[model samples]
Target: MSSMLSLRNVWVEYGEKVVLERVDLDIAERSFVSIVGPSGAGKSTLLRLLLGQEVPTRGRILLDGVPLKPECGPDRGVVFQRYSIFPHLDARHNVLFGLECAAAPFTGRLFGRARRIALDEADAMLAAVGLGDSGHVFPAHMSGGMQQRLSIAQALVKRPRILLLDEPFGALDPGIRADMHVLVTRLWREQALTIAMVTHDISEAFTLATRVLTLDKRRHDPHAPHRYGATAVYDLTLDRRVAAETAHTASITIDDNVNN
Candidate 1:
């Protein structure tokens, strides 16, 4: 598989504090990558880098072999743990916002034929995320899962090639999180997206991703904790079948332990 995104010798430093160092990675096209790490290990920072929201203090990032722009581009879309949507707008308008912005930067609104076409696209994307009937609903009226579904639709409506998820399911209940997993998996497959998700859930990381990466510091300074930075210490690629089997076995083991 060809690389869709590449990072070479990437480092993120804020003053004397180093968050990440010597980070080199290649994310293949259509691959689902889950990033896991301890607190302050730079997982979210890594996602920000992928989203073009942050530039590494040292080194570079490349998308499709070209140098990545510092600004967030339309090619990359992001969903956060907190619902990133317009509370005032209905679901349809929230999803239509991106298209409108892209079409008319100055006005941030589409007119007549263009507005109609954008609305149709937004509706289709809402349907794709199982929000077909909720287009007119406000965020305050929706459940957490529904809000997340709307968030996904909003991100996907723009037809971004890469999706960046920052602990997207962290705030949801287990059942809701499971449903989101199914939704995200289906979207990833159907959209042929290259996804980079940051999560604290190990099971989720292992279950949903084609590749799992663990970031940690190779060397730690006890006196000055920020002296060293986290890097990808473990990079494991899994076949879909293998990932399923492993996740299943893990589930059984956890269940048995709980019962015992």
Candidate 2:
């Protein structure tokens, strides 16, 4: 597959402190990539770069061979560790918020036919995230897993080319995290999404990611601790045969149901 995103010799600095350094990476289309490292390893910084929330001090971050803008756009979506859903809006309305914001930035409200279409899309997205029956419920009323699912739904309602996750399942329990792993993998295949997730869990990184990238500062000096920043110390691609088969089987089931 062609490269969907690339970071060429990227570096980031916060005043006198450096966060990332000499980062060169490329992500292929529709690939699930997970980033793992110790604390303050610049994993979340990398996601922020991809999200266009921060600009690199040096080098380039490219999407489809074009330099990405500093501002966020429709092409990139994100889900953070915290359930980033609206507290005031219900599940369905939260999903609709993305469509609303994209369609009308100043006023996040739709009307008439546009409103109907957005509602329909929101319903489909809620169903896709297994929150169909929870459309009327608020995020506070839902479980952690359910809230995370709703966050995913809200992000995907825009059909972004890339999804950036920052410790998406960090707060969930083991069982719920496992369920989220399956849900994310299924969604990646079904939606043909290119994903970049940052997590501290080694197992979760290995389980959900086709490619794993480790970021940490390579050089350490007792006298000068903050001289250097984190780099991509390890990049490994796993065998995704099992994931492929699972997605294929699910696709077949859907097709059979549609045909029947």
Candidate 3:
């Protein structure tokens, strides 16, 4: 395992309003980290910066020590709350689309053995996310959780070095949310994925993260950079890992089937 992501002194601002300030973090070879904060606290902003969708107003981000580029790549996957799948395309085709785009950007197609491998890869990804038999179904036929699962598989089909997820489970029911948490954690561990997600759920933060980061849009300290604001990083391996994956470890003791 090797280091996958690093951010140093990153600052993001929109016009006169700065959203994030001097944020530095390192997500190691195999880790799941979450950034949790109040709304308008620039949690999504941080993920955008990492994905190279938004350039830092001040500092820079490095993926595996390479300066963050200004575009997305196969090595950097993102599974957002909104599934990017085309409603017309079936599940396998949707995942295949990402693989085809990434692994074959120019020709953008696979033939002979390559075609078979690509389809197989797409099927495997779908299976990993518990959509094993849904390859032929369209997005319209799926539930919110299923669509989100499809989104994750599409993003991971390219085997991204870093997984950037923005509130991936927000739309699911509580039961589904818990199950998705376990699904993602197991994926991260088994695949050695380096993930950084933005979430408001503090218990979710503790459950899924190897570390937790908090962003406060309110500038309270004079040294807090007169720009966007201040962010704090917490080493949560202790507090978070102590909570086993058992259902008893969850903060909300609701009996309602969450994923339903």
Candidate 4:
């Protein structure tokens, strides 16, 4: 398999506070991988690096064998943990936002070729995520799962080279999370998308990832506010089904969440 993304000897620092040191990773094409670790382990930070949301202090980040953009582009789509969609915008509009932001002309803007294509793509993606008929509904009125799904659809509509998810199912209940897991799995199979999702829930990582990457603080500090011991990366393609099933047994507690 060809490599879709790579991080080599990467280092991240926040004003002298080092987050990750000498981090290296490679993401293969059409693979669904998850980043798992304790809080402040640089899991989310890894997603940020992949999406080009932040610059690494050292090393390099690449997309399609090239460097990434400064603030992300249509080539990369992101679904944040919190519903990042506009509250007032309905599901269709939310999906359309990504297209509108695209460097391409007329996309998701005025009525024309770009608008038509953007709308059509959004419709297909929404349908794929089980939001076909809910395109007209505002995200505020939709269930948590529906909102999360819309965020994913919006991310997928643009055919991004890599989809970055930050704890997408973190807010859903156990049953709903399971259902959404299936939905994501089907979509991944259909589109052959390259995904890198950050999740604290080990079960979600196991059930959804082609690989599991455990991030850790590369450097040791006795007084560090948060210290991650060591990064542990695992390959799951050899036994994804087993990993998923075994992961389900350790579903994170979601008593207050809703079921599918």
Candidate 5:
């Protein structure tokens, strides 16, 4: 219920073009927030700001009431639409890489007892993502769903406080996307993670998120579209009971479609 992330009058501009302006938001701890908007609405840009990959052109961003760092840190983990795993490494090793990087930044490797422990943790994370038996499988041999599970495992191995998802299931088949929906919902509950996901699907936004945010330009300039920037035009907070009902209804709808 406490605020985990706060953006105060944030703005992101590039030279003469403005992307986001006068954006103010407060994301609570352990809350699942879904961002939905049209193309060029700066949805991904907002996600990047939260990931510490980009800083605001003005205003301040606070994490747990402290000023956020300018670089990405272990406290936040991100899963992109494309699988961000190493093709050469197997599932276990791919997950292990995160631990190794955090433990040994200079060499990005571990050894002996440390190596064994890290592998155990990696296997545990893989199991959590339903890839326990596939630890030895290479990503190239795995199906799309399996590869995405591996990607989630890799992001989660570091045990980040916040998880940022950018159209993570957009590329999957409908059946696979439904399965991933269940997987992500379960993980979000089990891990008690604060998730901020940018999605193109309106149904997905309502189904998975405790809060839904729509970004768009409040005032458009016909002469110069770039003269204005997008902001949170609509913010809707769903009650827990309503969110559960929505998820249930969505699941049934997906099941019916798949059956047909």
Candidate 6:
């Protein structure tokens, strides 16, 4: 497992306010990492940095040992807390849209063999995320869990090297969320994706991540509470067996659904 991404003494600030400070981490290939923290702890900020949505005020972010550019690219994909799917498009088209946007940015359309290939890929991606039969339905008609699965499929249609998730299951019911847990773990394994997820649920973080990172404001100063920003306060590498058990249990849950 070589390092896929690395943050070296990263810092991010907006105007007079600081959001992150001295954040250093190395993310291995095919690793599932979950980030947890209190409110105002800059968890989203970290995700944005990785997504290349925002550049660090100082320091560097590297991918494959090269400095990462400060912009989103095909190499990385993201699923936000919100469904992030278009209401008008059906599930299949929603996934196809990602391919079109990436392949034909100016016209936002795909044609000929490229179009057929993308559509075929989209169908496979939708089915992989457990929405094979629902491709004709719009997001508005789908349940909360289904919409989230659609979101995941859209991100994955591009076959990104890294996947970033922001509270992907926060809006679902408990049972649906559990099913999603299984779906996501299965996708991670089958696709060999390097994942970085931001989740407020401590239990969810512990359950899904091979590595857990806790971010918080680490420096305390009586003069200015906000002067210092958040950083990785705790990093835990779970035992291999624990992660295996979680994936195993989630698989059983998915199997039960099929039987039912």
Q: What is the C-alpha lDDT profile of model 3 across 146-197, one tens digit per residue?
A: 9999998988888887899999988899998988988998998888788899
Tell how far residue 176 is off in model 3, in angstroms. Answer: 1.5
Question: Model 2 misses residue 155 by how many Å?
Answer: 0.6
- In candidate 1 the C-alpha lDDT for residue 165 amounts to 97
- What are the lDDT scores of the predictions, listed in order? 0.91, 0.88, 0.79, 0.77, 0.92, 0.89
lDDT order, best first, reads 5, 1, 6, 2, 3, 4
**Residue 133 local lDDT, model 5:** 97
On residues 1-260, what C-alpha lDDT tens digit does candidate 6 reach at each position?
99999999999998777889999999999999999777788999999999999999999999999999989988898998788899999999999999998999999999999999999999999999999999899988999999999999988899999999999899889999999999999999999999999987766777888998888877878787767899998787876567655745644543353234
In model 6, what lDDT does residue 222 have?
Answer: 79
Q: Which candidate is the best by TM-score?
A: 1
Residue ranges of candidate 6 with Cα displaced over 4 Å: 243-260
Per-residue lDDT tens digits of candidate 4, residues 1-260?
A: 89888888887777757778777777899888887776677788778878878888888888778887668777788988798889989999888877777734554365678678878888888888999999899977999999999888888887877788898888899999899889888887888788888887877787778787766544566887443333443334526758766775544422111111
TM-score computed on alpha carbons, candidate 4: 0.86
**RMSD (Cα, Å) of model 1:** 3.6
Deviating ranges (above 4 Å) for candidate 3: 1-3, 218-228, 233-235, 239-241, 244-260
Deviation of model 2 at 154, angstroms: 0.7
Which clashing pairs does model 6 show?
A: none
Worst 10 residues of 5 by lDDT: 251-260
User: Which residue segments of model 5 deviate by more than 4 Å?
Assistant: 244-260
Residue pairs clashing, model 4: none
Which residue pairs overlap in candidate 5's backbone?
Answer: none
Residues 162-236, candidate 1, lDDT per residue (tens digit)? Answer: 999999999999999999999999999999999999987778988999998888888878999987999998788
